[model samples]
Target chain A: MIDPVLHAWGWEIPVYLFLGGMVAGFMIISGYFTLKGHHKHSDFSSFYLPHISLFFLSAGMFALFLDLEYKVHVWRFYTTFKFTSPMSWGAWILLVVYPMLLLNTLVSIPKSFRNRISIFDRISDVINRYPALVKNIGAANMVVGAVLGMYTGVLLSALAARPLWNSAMLWILFLTSGLSSAAALVHLISPDKTEREVSAKADNGFLIFELLVIVLFLVGLVTSTRAHKQAADLLLTGPYAPVFWGFVILAGIVLPLIIQLLAVNHKIRHTPVAPLFVIAGGLLLRFVIVAAGQASVIP
Target chain B: MSSRYAMVIDTAKCVGCMDCVVACKTENNVPEGYNRDWIVQDVRGTWPTLHMEIRSERCNQCDEPPCVETCPTGASHVHDRGGVVLVTKELCVGCKACIAACPYDARFIHPDGYADKCTFCIHRVEQGLDPACVAVCPTRCMTFGDINDPNSQVAKLLTSRKWHTLKAEAGTKPSVYYLT
Candidate 1:
């Protein structure tokens, strides 16, 4: 039986977290490509990815809205911003994100598409008039993307009630995972050989960092107080172990890492399967963390 | 000086009859399948020499409430009169951040899509009366009053007896105290 006291947050949360992290990941990569001029080589990197990132982010926000019991009262979140509250920070961040993503998407549209769409032509003309503005937007995307990535983890870590979530390593772990997942997504979609190689290499690096951060997170929890140790046990030897090991570790990180490495080195052909695993792993990581965190209450 | 309202529960006197639980439910009109207060039985030691401690649990109304800190809106705030942690339903988006942040597991999602928890019977206390739980407890095990007032029963009990708060290490500095 599910413990009543320990099951307040349900399935919706992990889904929200996963989507939020994915958006951040995609934004960071898209921003990086735009800034570094990789967009010049691949039209997919410049245009499609940023729009896709915004789409996913909007979907994620919708999921978050659905989770709210008082959906009509959501305006209250904007009435006053509390510096101490992570939720408040997240709300404001999301507010900034929508407009920023829209701006990026507008500027990245190809001239051919802009010619066909008069509104896009006018918007692109204005944006193209100032080269520095485009660069500034790209930089803003990178910064905002990083904050959005870290915020997902910080949101959970801020909750002191759940020992499993109160880890300093969580934010780093989440950011790296976002980066890896984003890279994997870009690698899967980009037709350019150089672009795919770069993203694949980056994903491999991010996966390594994510693995270390996960280990450190567990170490910190296990070496802490009794409650924290119990929280660690939830993932280590408790009911969640199988999912954590099978899905999050093996399938999500290790298997994806191996596949990506083989693909990068030309030992194996790059298939859609590796990126798919990375995305699934990213979603599952959020799911396991959120579910187990709720279960690891101070009973 | 303003009152800092608190509860001093004498666990030794409690029989776990759940009078307070029923009273709180009825008084607050808390939804079914949800609660504002309950009882916890902590069983210790081997079977032959086993001992069980039955304690009544409710919102601690923490001085440094994590729930308040985590709330996106100011829906969860400490009342100016007595520092009572209360939720303003109209402002609550029911994001469940406070529910996750509370160590005591005191808060619940009200059916109306707002967070709900113990209010220290603020309505009754405003009229200089005890909370419903304290008034109905058969053992008279609960003392509710201003902890800042030395003359108050809660203050007197706290000063004279050795007591502890649940999850003291949580750093919440809860207003509720339990006498062992």
Candidate 2:
């Protein structure tokens, strides 16, 4: 039966997308600093970010697991890989993410944080000996990070059945959103002033790009076809408008971006407000998009 | 010859009797409040100039099935016999990606933890019988056969009638057609 309302997904997917996006941001940030040889001023990028990302990634995986109806059949995802299926790609990416996160910690580990575990310390000592391999690992982080970020949106966009998520621009929007979120978290939690300033500045830039992508996403939808126009309306004037405009645009990106821009210019003292808002906004964006996408019908 | 099964439904002949719906439900043991097939009554224009189309709809069983392409575990697949879409429960992870990918709104997450939908009664078709819905259609409006066989009724109907597939713009190349 063809019905007007869609109802296949719920909160778990949005939460998972949000966490996955943040994890991607951390990897990109860490990779950037490690490759640039400026990790000394931003230990958060190399060391803490990976650990935090691991925690978040694990939680995100747990959320995905919870969303699965046949919990025991979860292993079926690994049995065969479908190139056209985003879930298959995501599963393999997630499996490799663990090693990448672990390898990242050992590459440029701070001494004070080392020797806590005998096995880890020995492995870290052995791995740190190879500078070239370590740098390659850093590069891998960025590449894998980027793929993971885009895959979250690609997962939705590949479903041509849902017009709202069918855009080619969705992956770019999600990737940018993920990078911005990672930068915001680093800005908020990093101890080093240089790291804070660098990440805050980057966050501001990403936030600006995210806003642009969001605008372009709707425009792309509205201008295409009738079903697509209806999808755009779901966010513009439909039920999802308030959360999209109020939380994602106003509170999430615009306000945080404004605060960070001021702080970057030394117009105001740095505070936790902006970064927190950015992170929350990133989460809200996923929820609203997923919900609205589900609500959009082909008719 | 390779068989490409298709269903040709005459909208002009169908009276919205719902016999097909009930037959499919009982034949498939579909759970309550869920259906493997259903009726849609679409009325256009005002009361003085009304044009009504009553369609008994189910899965389109498309040639380029999104459900098959999007299934991570190879659970949703096309039958080797006639390109009929079927979901194998043994490998299904119950992710509902198929449900989201189906533009027809045909699939549902089965309570037993797998994606479920109208299979066109593949078992019955395999046993050399008409599908329950087609067999029981009161007006004899539904014709099911291999469209690849030019001699088949379905193929003949398609040639003689002015018919259209739903959501043709979706590029699914649906197997079902509605004859005007």
Candidate 3:
């Protein structure tokens, strides 16, 4: 059994973090596609991704809400903003995110759906009237999505108590992982040949960067104080070693990279298994980090 | 003048009976299966030269508390008069950020959905009485008073004895001192 003192945070936190990162990843992928004019090649990239992003983000928010002990008093989170508090910054960032996502979803409505749905038609008409506004929205999405991706890692790193989380590399690690997962998602869903090829290539680059970041993250921990070294050991040689090495490192990173590379080189046909492993790896990364960080605390 | 209250604990005199832990829980009404204070025992060296050190630990009530700074709604704050770290239940969102930021692991989630920790027994201190744990110590190992007052026991203990604080590298500047 885990020590009671270390149980302050549980499964709810990792689930929330996974969902939050996934949403941010989707936004970044969709924003990049829209900005680079790749949306014309794939209908899924242009219209459905932002809506899917919103749905995932809303679900993540619900998970966060469930973690709070006082659900009814959650409104207090927005009453005042504390600059030093990452939670406060996240709350404000989320407030801006919802509206931007909604507008993106409204503007990307397909003509078939817009014709069938009066509300979508009216919304799309308002958006079409201000053609220049769409450019600004796409730019805003990329900026906000990047921040949201890094913010998840910054939130944990800000906690000085957890040696495993105090490293600056955490933000970069989380961002690269988020990007890789987002690209993999697009690769899986987009039927357009050109779109899939571009996404697959981007995901391969992100996976390589993610592996480097993860290595740096662990190196930073192991080279620091005794407490930090102990934190690193929890994943390196301790009880969590098998999962960290087997599931997270080999299966999550190596296998996905191998599969994506083969697909890019046309050595093998692309399959859903590659992206599925990437997503699983992303979620496992958060869970291991959270659980091990808590376990490594000095009593 | 602002009063900076502090504690001076003599580790040599601590028997590790957990009286302070019991007293703190009772005085603070800490829920079952939770604790506001605990005793940590460190044993060093091999069998022939074995040496053991036991110390009762709780919130250090640091001067620059990370818990207060990380609290999103200002629920964790230092008491202005006596420098006691406290939690305002009404404002706490129960986000557990303070718990994560506290290196000492001194804070816990109360059943009422708020962060809870040792308040330095502010209710008793305000009435000019010793905190429950301090008052009930059989060995009189724990000293509590305004460290700024030259005449106070805690002040005299600090001046006369060699002392150290826990996790000095953390740079929190804890008010609680331990004498070996």
lDDT of 1 by residue, A1-299 (tens): 11123226667778778888877887787777777766556667667777888788888888889889899998999999998899899999998888878777776687566678788778867985787777777788889999999999999999989999999999898888888888888888887788788889999999999999999999999999999999999999999999999999999999989988898888999888888899899989998999899888775
Q: List TM-score per model, in order.
A: 0.96, 0.97, 0.95
lDDT of 1 by residue, B24-46 (tens): 88998977787788888878899
Q: Please, what are the lDDT tens digits per residue for candidate 2 over residues B1-180?
A: 899999999999998888998898899997766777888998899989999999988999999999999999999999998889999999999998998999899988777888888898999999999999999998999999999999999999999999999998889999999999
Clash numbers, per candidate: 0, 0, 0
lDDT of 3 by residue, B97-132 (tens): 898888888888888888888888999999998988
In candidate 2, position B177 carries an lDDT of 96
What fraction of the true interface does each of the listed models get right, in terms of native contacts kept? 0.64, 0.60, 0.47
Worst 10 residues of 1 chain B by lDDT: B28-37
TM-score: model 1 vs. ground truth: 0.96
Q: Per-residue error at B77 for model 2, in Å?
A: 0.4
What is each candidate's DockQ, to 2 decimals?
0.61, 0.60, 0.53
Instruction: State how far residue A5 of model 1 sits from its true place (Å).
Output: 6.3
Residue B103, candidate 2: Cα error in Å is: 0.6
| Candidate 1 RMSD computed on C-alpha atoms after optimal superposition onto the true structure | 1.9
TM-score of chain B of each: 0.96, 0.97, 0.96
